[model samples]
Target chain A: MRLAEAWRVALDALRANRLRSMLTMLGVIIGVAAVVALVAIGTGTKQQIENQVEGLGSNLLLVVPGRIQAGSAPTSSPLTLDDIDAINRVVGDRSRVAVTIASGETVRAGSRTGFASMQGVLETTPTVFVRNLDRGSYLTRTDVSTGRRVAVLGAGLARTLFADRDPIGRQITIGGVRFRVIGVFEPLGQSLGVDRDGEVHVPVTAAQRLLGTERIDGIAIRAPDRDRIGDLSTAVVAALTDRHPDTDFSAVTQEQILGVLGDILGVLTGVLAAIAGISLLVGGVGVSNIMLVSVRERTKEIGLRKAVGARPRDIGLQFLLEAVLLTTTGGILGMLLGGGTALLVDRLSPVPAALTWWSMALAFGVSAAVGIIFGVVPAQRAGRLDPVVALRTE
Target chain B: MTAAIVADDVSRTYQLDGVSVPALRGVSLTVDPGDYVAIVGTSGSGKSTLMHLLGGLDRPTGGTLLIGGRDVSTLSPDEMAALRNTTIGFVFQSFHLLARTTAQDNVGLPLVYRGVGRRERRERAATMLERVGLAHRITHRPNQMSGGEQQRVAIARALVTGPSVLLADEPTGNLDSATGQSVLALLESLVDDGVAVVLVTHDRDVAARARRQIVMKDGLISETR
Candidate 1:
């Protein structure tokens, strides 16, 4: 049969049953669209998290006490000031390092009292810590070396402790011990699971004297040069292992953490995609059923074509083309709809959903495969029809 | 003399509810080229069955059935279709033109299978329409034409391939007397053109015009003249 005539026959069959065609297409549409939308959303959330983490200088590594992996973890370690000093001395000049100790403390100034993260940190913390501040001075090397109990309030902490007052130079009681307020930080949003703009800062020595623990809970570090971050990371690990060889403690890089995060997102995308792939299988079933029904409905037509010299392959081509056309059309529509939905969510909310070109290509290719797979049996049945019996059928 | 269509002891049987029903039993016949042959019988007397077997729509269960010197009963389904397309044309009792296709497209269907070019289809389908006296109904679908017009379109499609033989099952069975005679005149005209024609009919008047006639009864040939 001529290709044109085969298409004409296919189109005629599709047109003959409008409701069935539409219903059949629904399966493919929903299936492809779900795959596109869900994968985009999953990958988008992952991208957003990585962005937020990188904003805090992706080269920055966190050394929290104990071993902890996010989403699934055990409690952090009891890292202390001595450990921080040791790491700093070894990784000195190779990476920027900061030692920090944190305790929940209540600050009182003139009748206002507020809860804050009383972080006793070295002066170098602000340099390697990568913060954006809105107001007064950060701590100086003078403050840490001198153990001067001077404090820098995060933007939120400043708001709470001083309200509308000029907070710098004023003294506030932390755990009832008075300390001079040196500065207030800028409003930094969520980063690395920490609220940067909502904490209070003090000198590391003072925190130990006040908390009566010489131990620090965390240390933040940044490789001095990004190009050598991996080398620097290896060096830091060797140094830390050398310092406390048998303690079972380890050094982690932000890049490694990001890789772990990406893997998690990949699994999430795959799982959601498989769930959506259920719809494609359903769509394939729809194509099979529709083509089968078309064969039955066009029995005489099949007979007539058989009588007229249509090869079995020719008959098969007609049915296969119809299925391919139907599914391909559905795939196109689904891509447009799914991409548009993702765009809409990205624009209207913080969904961060974005459709990639490959996603659309994947949808189309899968839909075509589905059509061929589903179209085969019905096309073969139509091809194998007996002309005489079909013509004589009422 | 060599025959255009010859069946030698051809037998065809069908399985119905597990019982083998013989529809054609050792039926043998011959038709010379350019002869108008009519097959006449009562309903279920195997005349339609004979027409079907001769047309290559069904294979004979036993013996040899030849069209233009080829044993059609031995051909594969696809090969038989090729034979039917190139060697024979068909017109059915019901004017079985596709319901929604224009008369021209219906006529062009055979040409499509024949792999004729677009220009050739246009020229040949139009000429066939003119031959059948339905030139004006070329663009009209089957439902838009009268029974007589529809039959003419069917005849045009059958003849468009220019086969040596035309097998028509009850060519004018659904038409009125005037329309039936006009269709029969068209069939007779094919005989004049030296294209052998086989007509299956219950009407004696329809059968009478054939240059030769065969009668079938109970799956066997009862008479030939």
Candidate 2:
């Protein structure tokens, strides 16, 4: 028989038992939806992490003044500005690397008080960390050279202290000393558990003078290119170790951090996708079970068709087409549902989710395969039925 | 001329729990074109089994059966199905029209298995329905038609493929006498057109409508006239 006629007959039969067909389809719908949505969410989260890491600046390396031990507390020594200069000298060229130091302190403006992470940086801080001001001007060479107490409030800190008003040129008390807010930073949500929007930037000299400590907290170094980050990190470590006999410092490259994060996220997405795949298998089983029942129920109809000269392959093809139609229809509906669900979750929560074309296609392909794979047994039974006995079945 | 159907020493047996129960015991029969034959017997007399074997719906355990001069016993299952498709048509007593399908589509069903295209199938089905005097009810579903009309539709379906023979198993058993008479008249008209007709029934009146009759008892043909 022609495939089109077989499909038409199959569709008619399925329509005859509409409620049963729909109930059978529900399993596949839910399965595809869960798979699509879960996979989209996982992929979206991984993408978001990659973008955030990329935002931390090109070829970035962090130099911290502590020796991390496996089971013991990290032993720390003070990092000085001379160490930053020593690392720059060891790296050979000033344009090849740039550094910024950061510390935490409290700030007050009017009647409001908020805790702020204080960043002591040079004029190159903006370029090295890839930061830009949302308003006013950034720190200048003269401001850092003369130890001027000019500060740039992070987006969140600006919103907290100044509400909706602009904070440029306004004076805020930091570490019991007043500093002028020359700029306000654009919102940079969160990175590595630190709230980027809640930090304030000032010169290293002014910060040391005001906080009564010349000891630096940590230095962020930006290499000229990504390929040079490892070499630059080794140089910084060597320079610091030579200058400080105790060598209580660690230099971490961006590639190392990203590699570890990629491993963890890759495993996480795989586990989630596998869990969703199990549900699809369950749905396939549901299809097989329902198709078996449908074959049994339509035994007489099958006999009639056979008597009318339908070949065994025709009967089998008809049933197989029915199963595929059910699943593909369910797959389409599930894609819409999954896409809508991903959009809803993205809007309703902080967890990121996105629907990509490849995921949709993959889900659809898998559902079609599920239909054919599960349809075999029932279709074979129908194909192998004895026409005489089947006609006598009722 | 080659006979439309020839059954020689045909035998069919049922195996029930490793015990043999013979249904047709070496029964032989021949039917020619334009023949209107009725096989009549009570239940368990194996008339239905004989009809099934004659229609190529079942194979005989022993003996040779031929339809349209082709040896049915030697044909593969696929070839048997093809022979049924192009050479024979079957009408059941229940008027087994698919529920909710229009009469035209129902009549065209056998043609679908013949690989006829949709447009031509529809045209042929429409002409067949017209031939059965159901042109006005072409779009009506089986449930929407009367018992006699449904039987006419089944007849139209059987004739759609232009088969050489028509096999009816208790075709009138589900109809009233008047409807059964009309159905029988349709069968008679096909016989006049030189199509062989085989009717299987226990109803005496239904069997009497045929020009030739065979009576069966105890798995054997008792008489034929």
TM-score of chain A of 1: 0.86
Best by lDDT: 2
TM-score of every prediction relative to native: 0.91, 0.92
Candidate 2 residue runs with Cα over 4 Å from true position: A65-78, A92-103, A136-150, A164-180, A205-214, A244-251, A347-349
lDDT of 2 by residue, A1-394 (tens): 8877888888887898899889888888888898889888988897888878888787888887776344867554467778767877776655444545556788999888889998887777777777888989888879977999999999999999999998888899998899999999989989867899999989889988986777777777877777888787787888888888676678887677777888898798778878877888888899999999989988988898899898899999999999998888888888888889999998999999978888789888999999999998999999989999889888
- Residue B36 accuracy (lDDT) in model 1: 90
Candidate 1 local lDDT, B1-225, one digit each (tens): 678888999999999999999999999888787989999999988998898888878888898999878888567767887888888889988877888788988898888877787778878999999999988988899988889999999999999998888999998989999999999998999898999999999999888888888998999989987
Residue lDDT tens for model 2, B1-225: 889999999999989999999999989999999999999999999999999898889999889998889988789888888888888899998888888889999999998888999899899999999999988998999999999999999999999999989999999889998888888999999999999999999999888889999998888999997
Q: Kindly list the per-residue Cα lDDT of model 1 for residues A322-391, writing each as its tens digit.
A: 9988899889888887888878888898678868777778887899899998998998898888888778
True contacts kept of each: 0.62, 0.72
For model 1, the DockQ equals 0.66
Kindly report which residue stretches of model 1 are placed more than 4 angstroms away from their true locations once superposed. A68-79, A104-116, A147-187, A192-197, A234-246
Against the true structure, candidate 2 reaches a TM-score of 0.92
